[model samples]
Target: MAKDHIDPVEELRQNTAQPFEQAHAMPPSVYTSDEFLNEELEHIFSKDWFCVGRADALKEPGAYTTCELAGQPVLVIRDRDGELRAMSNVCLHRMSTLLHGNGKTRAIVCPYHAWTYNLDGSLRGAPAMTLNEGFCKDQYQLPQVKCQEWLGWVFITLNADAPDVSDQLAQVEEMIAGYDMTNYTEAFYEEHVWDTNWKVLAENFMESYHLPVCHSGTIGGLSKLEDMICPPGLPAFNYHTILKDEELRIAMAHAKNDRLKGEERRTTYLLAIYPSLLITLTPGYFWYLSLHPKGPGQVLIRFGGGMSNDFADDPDIDQNFADLKALLDDVNVEDRGCTEKVFKGLSSDRAVPGHLSHLERPNYDFAQYLMARINAGRGN
Candidate 1:
């Protein structure tokens, strides 16, 4: 198949290396061309630390789930020894996907030839292999991938040289230390496929510029442009703060803790962890979106959230979550409408880079990160 290609690194560098007043958005081809998407898959997704899910999801020894990373089938399982393992999901015999979706399994059994594997990915049993010559079971284990845990989230990478997830997110950890995220229980999780580029969804979450416009009916009424504070981007992530109006600040269902101070009680922090993790933290709760590109115009979104431990035992917890979920659903609908329209607009021949607003500093930082990865991959 012939592939459509674009040199996004050069285009991004040209568009972003200027004063904020003079800078423009990224080129249309960077979002619409299959060639650039392929490059991102190799240079960014393949080498970066990708967040999969919350660590609390795998509560049992045999709990497991499957996903694809950079087009490679992969699985994460909790072994009997209480350790999490990430490895290829492809079977050694016929290359069939070993598992589907998620479940509690005593052992991984391939549906193709009935080849079986232990919870640790070691080959446990193979039917009708007695006639084979010099087949050693010890040598047939599934290949392991690099995996790490941070702030109760599971992250994995295909590249052996990728930086440690903990090191990259150290500052973010310190900033949110008052949240006590490790003790936050998983209240809910859901997945959806959006008809927009992965970067489109990511950029949407990174900036607060649209909150007053796009989300007017839901959250916009409570936001003010002057209250937003955009922090300088760190080497590994970018963050911004939105202050809540005193009158609009509703008392949290969760009990207040001393770790947070006056402003912290009225502030919301939004963080973009480089390539794909988008997180939002509030005094009462937190939520995140882990993005995966399915194609040039499709993104797989894993969205989930939970309340802080202060509200873990609240009698009205269920009602609180219901209200939260409904608000989130409405906000998502508004965002989807805007992003899908932007994707279509990018396909037009007249499409070109537009001037960015002061509120879009995080988007500028994201472009820099994208360009750095592409250039590094090309050995430039």
Candidate 2:
């Protein structure tokens, strides 16, 4: 796989023309290989700024949650002092699991050996260590992971040695710099398990070519398909698709107030951060989407969002949330159905890496980024 001589961009350019045609498709093995999936888990997911949840999840002191990322179980907790901590969810003794799920707890007591850990991941007591055999309690704390909070979201990386989240995410940060994402609060959150590779979903999200057909009922008639589509530049990590008010009003009918009439609706934005996080920002609406690979052919998608401050307590917010969820569920179902069917083709012997049209610059960039990382043997 050390395609050192393979110019991935050049290869993509040859197959895709200016208007951009989806030329070269991913090879079959990319989706069905257990080996490649493991590599992605270790190298991409573990080392990247994987989203755990929103900062609001840890709003209360001693609030804790458990989640899995790249096949690794993780414990995220807000300590008594209101500091957030991320640690391996494995017990130091016998390597058993620690926290079971999300809850508020003063401390975590490992069920296996009753080994207890403080909210900050400090080893508090080891009930079974009677020998005192040169073992310091301080040395037995749960292993810590790199973590950071940005724009009201909690992100953690299993690779303690990875680059700073800011550094790795600079391009995306710059692209979304003008938006005030922190102003909103979590108004929606959900998760779905899909039967396709995470990259497939990423590729689909990075482009809008399928929006008209795949999301016709929800967004097609509402958006200026041609105008919203643009070449996603060198962030090589993500892309942005703009939707103006005309389209927004049509898709999100609930947003049809006089304040957003005509030109006022020209401010919808969709951004995909490198690796997995997707954020859609509007005049007063926000949505967060995170995708994670579960196995070779399975990926999990989590949804989160915030609303405008003015409407935080509005009862209509519930209806809006439900509507948005239904819209997304339809889109998800459409994407999953087509992608799973496409997976069968990608797994066929007739497949090979396809080309990218000029419009697929983002997709090409992402493919190149992933390939370069893998070929370089960089992993968590």
Candidate 3:
């Protein structure tokens, strides 16, 4: 006996085509199939504005970080002229990766050979290249990738025609105007690899349907499904609102600011920005997850958050961050357990699409985005 083969693209289009009231989850194959993952890497992630990290992380001139975007090695640096740049990390000589991790350096020197590049990615030195005929060092700079900074975050895209990240997230900026996130400073950052499909982790972040159950001991006690408001997805993002019954403990820990008032003071906004940017905003704090698909069953996550500048300047800021990290870690543990289980369940041959709760509207919209990207790849 064998499982029935399903075409992920068609199944996704059909499932997402149903009305919101009648929608179903995408088939398991969309998450478990290698073919579908490859298609996603090419059509969606590679062609979209993918967030890497905060611009503040590279605040000083000569600061740099290396990361992989859709399996392409990318180097992001701040030049001596104070310009932010993103470019291929591969060495022009023998194709070696030029940098690893993050650091501050005047030049990028390849480990394979002494081939060095200036901070701006211009070829600075090529050891023993004089033997090569017609090899112009001036013409051998690392290929450039499109990069932009929006509201303090750095985003890069492999697609030459992709819309600027600022334009894509313009609505999000307006929606969170009251919070003044641009003035926030990162309090902490961490990276983790989860044993779950990238979409599983993404959809998990989009909906609060699992909060009262999955996150029972942590933030769950502060929330109720009835208090959750599911807003429709925009062309580039989807958001939900959660109203606090009592003033948030974290908010109380910080000094009050007039930036947020009335219901905005008590409401939390959770946004999934298209392909892989997940953000959560409270009156006093903001955090985000920048996700990258490592494979069918692995996702690399960059998780971090910051407090309002006023809050960040508090005398007890260190203590506040410790408490926040503890709470966030507990919540992340719960999410990891749930999503890993979901990934295992998705592997079952009998796994099928399930009806979505009204609260899962963001997940529904995500499926629509996935379908649209897949179809667009085929020019359909």
Candidate 4:
């Protein structure tokens, strides 16, 4: 039977009901169906706290970044008082966008009508509005969106009553506290749109089972499947650890660092924070991807990487990150090819789900998470 005749919700529930040993890849319709994507947008992306980037990127009082979430224009800006705030990026005057990409701006100005707003999103000026008898500058403030900084990452949500980002990730923070991730400074950031579902790229990042084959030309050579530790996932996230090869010295804890001990010093954490933040945090460096779906077959990605403060003073810090960028770029190319190919396969009429390797425990938990969110909305 064609996927059109299949009930996506029922299939999703069955997939989640399976035990880990018997779990299979989610059906292709989950990735290839517009209906499923819409449900996900409603229940997950719109309601959950989504990571945009690092808080430090906007450390300057006037710096701000704009992004779209669930088709809503959102802005994350540092107010003059040095507090980070998230609010509607749309102008109240003509609904024009207040800011364009990322920049340091003293105030939000609308290009269409020159309606100006303060860094806190209050109306500072509006031209040609005094003649209107009902106009109130104080009543026209841009709506506030909930935003929080966790471990230096900036996360925002459209829901007014969503649980706090920090509270949701408390377990993850405790587990990886030895790295002192808050001190890691982001060295670079980039954006890209991939020709695959957001979940495909996320699951690919969640597991090491594919390293030996999918990433053979890059860091795969350094990854040993047996050495990776895959434990059961916590409610809000899933994590796995891999030991670094000694030759990859920067990936291990720096010589001057004493926080990590024994195997912990060399372990690299791969954490997937629901619903779409993927982080690869090592002792000496880190990188992350924050994903939002463009549609069923494409995802908008915010990508960034940086080094530990321990290495920030190294004379070779510049050269060190340059080389790391090259390797990350190559690894990304490999991952893009693999994920896009998988998406293409999912579109085929003969596409079928298959059982997963134990290394993919995170993928299983991810499916459960997706199922729970979508299933919860059926009564509404």
Q: Pick the candidate with the highest TM-score.
A: 4
Full-model lDDT for every candidate: 0.85, 0.69, 0.86, 0.92
Tens digits of lDDT, candidate 2, 76-181: 8998888888999999878999997677887889888888999888889988577968878888778887888877778898877867766766766565444445
Error of 2 at 118 (Å): 0.9
**TM of each candidate vs. truth:** 0.95, 0.82, 0.96, 0.98
Candidate 3 residues lying further than 4 Å off, grouped into runs, are 245-247, 252-256
The superposed Cα distance between candidate 2 and the true structure at residue 350, in angstroms, equals 3.3
Q: Model 3, residue 376: displacement in angstroms?
A: 1.4
Judged by lDDT against the true structure, how good is candidate 4? Answer: 0.92
Q: CA shift at 329, candidate 1, in angstroms? A: 1.1
Worst 10 residues of 2 by lDDT: 247-256
lDDT of 3 by residue, 240-290 (tens): 999865645565323456767677777888989879989887777778999
Report the CA-based lDDT of candidate 3 relative to the real structure: 0.86
Query: Over 4 Å off in model 2, which ranges?
Result: 1-23, 128-136, 244-265, 313-315, 352-357, 378-380
Worst lDDT window (10 residues) for model 1?
A: 246-255
Candidate 1 lDDT over 186-253, as tens digits, reads: 77888899999999889999888999999998989777899898866887899898976555323232
- Model 1: residue 120 alpha-carbon error in angstroms: 0.9
Ten contiguous residues minimizing lDDT sum, candidate 4: 1-10
Whole-structure CA lDDT of model 1 = 0.85
